[model samples]
Target: MGFIDQLKTEYRVGGIVQRLIFWNIGLFIIPMILFSILKLGSVDIGIFDWTNPFSDDFFSLSSNPVDLLWKPWSVLGYAFLHSGFMHVLFNMLTLYFAGRLFLTFFTQKQLFGLYVLSAIFAGLVYILGYNLLPLLVGQTAKMTGASAAIMAILVATAVYAPYYEVRLMLIGTVKLWHIALVFIVLDLIYAPLDNSGGHIAHLAGDLFGFIYIKLLQSGSDLTKGVSGTIDFFANLFKSRKSAPFKKVHRNTTPPVRNSAVKPKDVTQKQIDEILDKISQSGYDSLTKEEKDFLFKVSK
Candidate 1:
């Protein structure tokens, strides 16, 4: 396959998290390229200009509530736009780590919903902080990045499985909550130093993650709203079809069995037993054989 074709294939099967990363990277690069070309042609469109905070840019959430009236999409669009190379790099890396961890015990729908909801929540909180806080009053700021959504995934995973162990280079093994706490502490410490809006958004994401998991534990799923909205839009774009009329026919041929095909060794009973063990304790409670069996079954 060609390079572009390979990338398309990867995006098709890389799961929701990888698709999200691709989206962020694409939005960042495509706008920059379009902006450069437009500038060269002396075309000054306010929509493509990221430097002007009050301009009609498609991304970057502004602190001014009045600006939101014209750029409502920025609430979620900002998460897909990055300020710089390092900004995208670290955010994408954390997304990969936290996203994979979150998916271990959750569904893809939940992850995507949490990401979207958290970003919107964080953007609103950022704007509110800039507006009401004594230290940030009268300050206007525009923020863009995936840090808030990434933090939501990370914090959600830690809350769901606090004791989950992850080994780091030179630091050995540590619990997931340990890593989550460190990030939260860093955000709190840096909120007053610089990038205060970004830090506030991160904290907002952390709060949303905790709330999402707590509600989930109480048998309330927040992702259902996201899923339903997605389904509605998807169906709106889909072409309707009618069932074809068919006639039933009788056949006298007997069924044939292939001797070459072997029956599966793993049965539903065995799978249920393993799942029960995991539920009663944790994934670590499974034996080597059980883990191997589960892995193979998953494949």
Candidate 2:
């Protein structure tokens, strides 16, 4: 296969978190590259000028309802745009680490659901905070970046592995929930100082992540429909690749019924793989289903 085809095959098998990171990076870079080419080539269209924040064509969700209505897609688009190199770097890194930690205990579908739902929630929170807060009344700001989504993933990981210890550079070993508490407190403390709208969005994402997991532990899977949504969109765009139909000859006589076979025991290879994942991450990283499977086989 060609390199592009190989890459596509890999992407098809890669989990949702990996796909999200790739999409975020691609979205962040492609706009600027396209705009730069248009500028260098002396394209004088008014749309090229709209790439700036001062223009309405910018991909940022604004605090004003009128501005939001003009470009409704910005609510989701803004989450993939980055203000600076360091901002994107930090956000992507947090997503990579936190996503890995979160996926250990949650399905890829759940991760996708939480990331998207939290972004939409954060955008609304950002708009409401800017428009309704007494000190910030009548103020408007353009919001961009994946910080809110990253915060949701980070807090989710910490909640799932509250007592799990992780060793950090200069910090030695610290409990996951302690780290989450520190972030929550810091965001609250700084909300009044600077970037208040952004902080509010972060807090909103944190709230959503916490609630998502809490409900999930109670046997509610918020992501149950996420896969259906994805499949619907994918099928809409995918080319027809169905296998050729075949007709089979039918037997004249009825076949005798056979007894139902009992399932085989769990294999050593499967247990080893689960054990390896636990060793690399932690016990709290195991999903409830995984825990149940382990319990059943341990006896």
**Steric clash pairs (candidate 2):** none
Tens digits of per-residue lDDT, candidate 2, 147-206, equal: 888788778878777998878789899898887888789999999899998999999989
Q: Point out where model 2 deviates above 4 Å.
A: 1-10, 45-58, 235-299
Please name the candidate that would achieve the greatest lDDT relative to the true structure: 1
Residue-wise lDDT of candidate 1 within 97-194, one digit each (tens)?
Answer: 99999989997778999999999999999999999999899998888898999999999999999999999899999999999999999999999999
Q: Cα miss at 97, model 2 (Å)?
A: 1.0
Candidate 1's TM-score reads: 0.78
Candidate 2 local accuracy as lDDT?
A: 0.76
Q: Report the number of clashing residue pairs per model.
A: 0, 0
